[model samples]
Structures are given as structure tokens and as C-alpha cells.
Target: MTMRQHAVSDDFLRPDSINAFTDALRGAKYNVDAVLERLGEAGQEGLTRNQTMPALDRLGDATDAQADLIRLFPLQQIVPRSRLAAFLDVPALIEAGVLGAIGREGIHADIDVRPYGFTDAAGEWSGWVAADPIPGMDSIVTRTRPNYVLGVSPASTSLAQLTVPDRVGSALDLGAGCGVQSLHLARHADTVTLTDINPRALDMARLTLALNGLDLDVRAGSFYEPVAHDSFDLIVTNPPYVMSPPTDAADRLVYREGGFAGDGLVRHVVREGASHLA
Candidate 1:
């Protein structure tokens, strides 16, 4: 499988460019409710299974800025430049590293952008999560993307929702991917720190928070290495938890594979977590 090269965090953080890009999304109502309403029930259901054609078919011949983005983002289709420019800053998108020029054909997304929203007792939180597309996504032809940093997923969102929303002085989101958990933590914690083994994931996390007009501390390293000297009032993690059949270390994936034997990663985190919590 030929893996597609993705635009990193630095590529998308231009001040003016990002400002324009987000403004356009807001003007177009490109949030979860709007996109879901546009896709309809059937299309939304198909999307969960990684099917894009249903959504694409439902959005046939639409000519609005939100429609353009819905096609370009979730459907992963190359869109007419003119139509996209109506609702998005095409040049800004290119500068921000989300849109790639396809010569004279059109523009394509270099990363996945999807609407994400959740409601807690405090009310509702919503925003888009941008990251490397999963390899087997219907719109993505590749079979595997080893360095892929995931966007909001079922497992990740489940963990976020299950987390206790107790107010705290500080919180740590270990193995933070695309900053989803950190975003949730920001609503309750006075300060939030996100750490990840993959630097690219850290980059995406920063962009995700920045796009949503939130700020936090981001560090790079495995587990507690970056925050060894520090402590937090709360700690949350949705760690890599896949178990491989063979004992071979090479069989593990960085995102899912914990370097240790069965459940070792979680155990290690648990053992070390006490020292870092107040």
C-alpha cells in the first residue's frame, strides 16, 4: 500500500491563514449538526462504516460553501476551486497545509477533517478534528499509514465521555492523539498538559486546540518521561492497547502496540501515575 504524505502541524498554523480558514468554517456552519443534517441519517450511518459514496450521493450538485467543504473533507473528493473559494480561503487552506493543489484539476485535502461534538453537564463542546486519515478509509486508497495520528474515533470519544468531569488544578492527557481528550479536560481542568510518543501527533494536537481557540501545554515523549518532574491533580489516558498474537516486538503498531507483554503499558502507567498526581 502506498501511503500518502501528510501535511504536519507547522504547515497549518500560519496566523492569518488559519484565521481565515476557521472564519470560513464558522460562516458556513460547518459544525457537527450542520454536516450531519446535510448528510442525512442514511449517509451519516454509512459514514461510520467508512463509506463515502452515500454521503457524496446525498450531496449531489449542491453549490454552497459548506457543501464544498463537506465534499472536500469527509468525502475526500477533489473539489472545484471556485466553489470552494466561495466558502473557504483556498489560498489560506493551502498555506495551512490542509489543502493540496491538484494542478489545474482542483484541490484535495492532505489530511482528514471531520466534525466532532459532545455534550457534558456543562453543556456542549464542538469542533473539527484534523489528522492523518486512517489507511482503510473508503476515500483513502492506502492500506496502512504507520505514522498516522488519529482524529476523533469511537474508542477515543468513548474514553472522553467516560472520564469524570471533576474540576482540578491540572490534568494530564497521556498518549494524547489529535488533542481530543485534552480538549475535554480543558473544560474542567484549570490547566491541561498533553503528551504523546509521536511528535506528529503532538503537532496535530496543537493545531486542533489552536483551531478551537484553546491553549494548553504540549510535550513530546513516551508516557511520563516529559512530565517526570511535575505533578497534576488529574490524569487521564487512552493508551495503546492492542494485543498481538505473536510475541515478536516487530508485530506491534506504534498506535496500538504497547511495547510490553499483555497489558504491560497500562500497568506501567498505573504504577507511575500515583507519583505524578496530587
Candidate 2:
């Protein structure tokens, strides 16, 4: 797709754009049933674990002629938000049995859900809190702070942007939250290993890669645990650096806490990374 075809202005999230996107999805067969299933699943769970590309790919596989039709739809083009939310909302509506499909007139239902901005790291994105029970995972709603450390922060993006691009080499991204750095590095790196201490973050990173059509190895473990020594030409980490109070152990989310006092996490990573670098 051309830049203009995919590019949406800052105001792209307006009601009109959403209506257009809904109409486009409703017109496609794969979008109708599959998107509904996804949204329904999301309502039961806070998020969807399955990636979006496979469903789109399955649409193509189901019918040869529809493959090109799916390509032309460009759901991402109408609104540059995370595909996970889009996929989840559709299924949520379908599962509720409130709408047969996302017709233009039915767009109001989405607005009612109050899809507001959740994080603004690499791109503008929004998330909706499901009122219904989240499937499989615990139903506990995670309370988030300003989270100077959660999601994709500026430090992570800066490392990614500053890294040399358009080169082929194996790269390792330690603590790859949301996979922003890994995704940018993928522009030049042949392969990327995204390691994270939190499985939820790895899950989000996988969704990010899927949305962008980029592939990376998503492993759940502490820094460098999933990777071999002397295997990476480039290793990058934007670790948890915030200092928390001694009594407020609950304040430290897995993505934000280093399990050490002061800059101990950073120091440890630097020392350990030296041994792993190729």
C-alpha cells in the first residue's frame, strides 16, 4: 500500500473514520464472523492473545478471489490504532449479540464503549476495559499509574532510533516491552530475540509485531535467559529503572521493578551483557 493509502491524519480516530472502517469490515465475509469472535473473546478477557494476521491470512486461504478484496479493505488504513483493539471490539459486539455486523449505523455502539487512549509510546493507540469476565486469565483489572516505565517509553524508542539501520545481523532485545525497539531494529536486523520477564508484555509485543507484519522470537524469561551467550551482534535493553518505596511492594509492576535497590538492575544488566555480546 502507498503511504497516502495507509496514512491517516491526527484526527483519524473521529467517528467518521470509525464508521468507514466498520463498513469496510462488514462488507467482507471473513471480517464479519471472525472479527465478531475476536471481540467476544476480548470482552471475556481484557485482551486478545491471538494475532490478527493469521485471521486475515485465513480469509485469503478460504477464497482466492477474496484475497485481493481483503487486501483492498485496509482496516489499518482508516485508523492507525492497534489492530488488537479493532479485532477485539468486533468480537465483543458479536458475542454480545447486539449487532450482526458493524454497519455504518451501528458505529454508535463502538463510540459508547469509550475507546480512549491507553498508551502513547511508538504510536497513538487506545484500549477498552472489558466489563465482562476475561477468559482464561485472572479477572483482576490491573491498576496502572502514570507508569513512567510501563509500555513503550522514550528511552526504548531513543535506543531504537539511534541504532544503525538497514544492516543484517542477529539482534537481542532484553525486556522488550511492546516490542518498539525490536520492531525498529528489525528494519536492519535479520533476526530479533525479544526477551521479557513478564509474559503479558511478551504477548503485547507479539501483537505489535503481528500488526506490522514483522516477525520476531518472543520468549518469556528474564534478561538473556532465552538467548545463547556470544550469539548477538547487538543487544539492547531499556530496563526498569524507577526507585520505589520499601513498603510499597505492590507499587512495582513486573515491567517496572528491577528487584534491586538503586541502579542495581542497570548495573547488573551492563555487566552481564558484556559477557553475552558477540
Model number with the top TM-score: 1
Instruction: Tell me the RMSD of model 2 versus the true structure.
Output: 15.5
- Report the CA-based lDDT of candidate 1 relative to the real structure: 0.81
Q: Give candidate 2 misplaced runs (Cα > 4 Å).
A: 1-89, 92-142, 145-149, 228-230, 244-249
Candidate 2 lDDT for residue 237: 80
Residue lDDT tens for model 2, 1-278: 11211112213333544444344433443342343453344332323432335445444433332233232222111221233234435444333321234343232121112111322234543222111111122333444532222444457657766676546588888988666777666656788888987655665565445434455787878777777554778888888767652446655656667678887888888898887877
Please write out the lDDT profile of model 1 over residues 1-278, one tens digit for every residue: 22324355354565665677778888888999999899999889988888988888899898888888888887778998878876676776675667889987599887777778889878998887878765665855665555568788778988987888998999999999888998889999999999999877887887788788777899999999999999999899988887543366555556777777678878999999999988
Backbone N/Cα/C clashes per model:
1, 10
Per-prediction TM-score: 0.91, 0.50
Residue 146 lDDT (model 1) = 52
Strongest candidate by lDDT: 1
